[model samples]
Target: MSNLKPEPANAPDDPLRRTLLKGAGILAAGSLAGSALGLAPAARAETSAGLGGRLRGVQHFGITVQNMDRAFEFYTEVLGGTEVMRDGDFFGDRIQNTLLLTEEVRAVRDGVNPVTLGIPDLRSGAQRLDVRFIQFDNVVIELLQYRDKEQPTGSGKAFAPAQDLTSPAFPRAMHVCFYIRDDVDFNQFVRDLEAESARRGMSNVKANRIVRATTDEQRLGASLDSNTNRITEGPSAGWSLIYCKGPEGEQLEFVQVQGHAKQVFDGAYESRRKQLGA
Candidate 1:
């Protein structure tokens, strides 16, 4: 007789059977909820296909700043960005509704006791947000400045203390990364960044030493590499990178992709160009 016993039939106690039953129950509940919500069949199908089916590429990213003029000067002079538009003095019922600022939020902003509203105090206190769009070569950034309705312009009272984003370990800390143009010398670019900061009296802006991904392991582990399509030993096997701080201590990263990496990037760019018929 065979030493191994035949696998038992999938009973209710079986782990795999339990898991399948749970998954089916969840799916059935979701389908029922969708039907109750009057979701069209096509809409349900689209949802089942995932959000990527309806979503397009990124439009822009936003960063809140203390001083609009100072931030604008730093971005344009130091990093080479163009001013796109500016809008401000936003306040009213419509704006409040759009921002989902409830009465509790408004009460908190107005320095009212949240206990009266039967809720905890909300952190956001800005009466309005002034926005300026800056366009870089590859991306658009929206710079937002919160304003207090009662405070005078440029009084600095409207702004909150800056958060410490110096460490990547900080929760919600984010950095913008840019690619250096092929024509630009990577070493010279770092030198220029430091020089510009000093010349512009931006003491807060600082750049670290360049780091090179030279080994196959390093290339494979590069930030841009996808898990499914990693760059192991391609012509763009390695890359040069630098980390810097913006005037307000916002982290910035620059990369110059080398070897097979560049080839891969260029191929994608060409595909996008062809898709756009440009």
Candidate 2:
């Protein structure tokens, strides 16, 4: 989420890139297919487009957590992610200044009365922002823990395990989804998730059914059904998925996209483009 570069406009266009853009509208939709690098000359090339594309697809998924160690273990040890970088005690005068913390905010966090306060101090009550980056395939997960900070009221509790976070009513509610290898067995993955949940002593960490699109279903397109935990229709149709809760009750999804998933998405994108008269 930090040090992100800009997208290049002068990058030479490739046929595949053009085709993908014509189909999906945004590179992110097909980024997993390695189409994001189409603007660059080679893999990990240092071209401006390459540098920009790295920032474009997905640099990292940031997660605020109560305990960094627990989150790290859950991500790395349980979920088979690899730790790449860590920044402990990562806060400085410049960093604090960049955040532009006002005196009122600092006073509340520092446990001081802000109303009667005369001096305008802008330093944050937080001492350090401990952060760790975990790599999982093409994505990076940023696990952050705010240390020595005064937490607001009712902020101490983790997300409710049974909360319907996928509901459309909760606009900000979200889940991190991953694309699993095509050949891996979906049932086995579900079993592994169950085992991990039990091993971690998480009673609510359950895996949902791996929904695949079938012509027999009522819905004809790839759309998510939050209530049913099903992908009823669309490019993800026929693609299997499993949902589970992370260590901090964050929603997570693993999608099997090796088969007709791409075709489904491509068709959906193309349809939208046609409808829009693009």
Candidate 3:
């Protein structure tokens, strides 16, 4: 949910990504097909569009979780995803539990320096078992578990890292949103969701009114696309949220968005604060 880079305009790949995106849109609607659709470049090149919402497609996401095994199953089996990679090469030793392979992890693993962003939570996390899984579609979801921490109590401020705040309050900034395509087969998707919920016996499964209102509020307040907003559509009023326990007992969210999920910055809503030297 961090926007370390505001715009990738200067990057050389922008033009190519745009071209591929157009082709992908056509492919989605079946306007263009032949051997071209089967070609690897046709799909690979479009991955960039999927990440930035440029294609009006998908927005990449990362979910913080506790149980790598169960969470992975929840994502793959329950949510209907195909596993691209089953091993951990991102970490030097393929350690079951680690955040994205940051360069500093080696320095810390080798006992040369403490891990970057190492804090009490990391230390506490070391006591437990967890894992990370990245899907082929450039959708990277990380699952975590704190042997030391308990699941979220949920009545108070969510302990996860709020956009406006620095440093995690509860730890493992919880929850993740999955922005799916607009044309997903609604009937089957809902039936499977219901079946999965029932089979998994997940707690607090509901249409979640708070999420719908928030989605509408963001769309209306920010002058953004309401129809394309994935968070605002569905029988659950176009969007739905379900509270699920992460592998570590921390509360996690399986959010289904109709269009895209965007990031929020501190003081981001001030209309007069556009970047300028005025």
- Of the candidates shown, which would achieve the greatest TM-score relative to the real structure? 1
Displacement of the residue 6 alpha carbon in candidate 2, Å: 28
Error of 2 at 246 (Å): 0.6
Judging by lDDT, tell me the better candidate of 2 and 3: 2
Scored against the true structure, residue 120 in model 2 reaches a CA lDDT of 17
lDDT per residue as tens, model 1, 167-260: 8667777888777766777766766676787787777676654234566456334443121122346464655566777777778777767577
How good is model 3 by TM-score?
A: 0.35
lDDT of each: 0.54, 0.52, 0.36
Off by over 4 Å in 1: 1-48, 93-126, 150-158, 210-236, 265-278
Ranking by lDDT: 1, 2, 3
**Between candidates 2 and 3, the TM-score winner:** 2
Candidate with more favorable, higher TM-score: 1 or 3: 1
lDDT of 2 by residue, 1-278 (tens): 22312121122532223322432332243323442112221233234343443333445688877666677778888888876555433344444544434755677788987534432122333444455667665566877665553432112332212344544237787788876666766666666665786688655455554345444232223333321333447656666666666766777887765346666555555553344333
lDDT of candidate 3 over 1-278, digit per residue (tens): 11122112223533223433543454354322212111111233333434332232232244544334555666677765554322111111222223334545665677764433432233233322222334424344444333333432111122233234322245756454443444664333434454575577543232222224556335224322222323453333445344433333444444343322221211231221222111
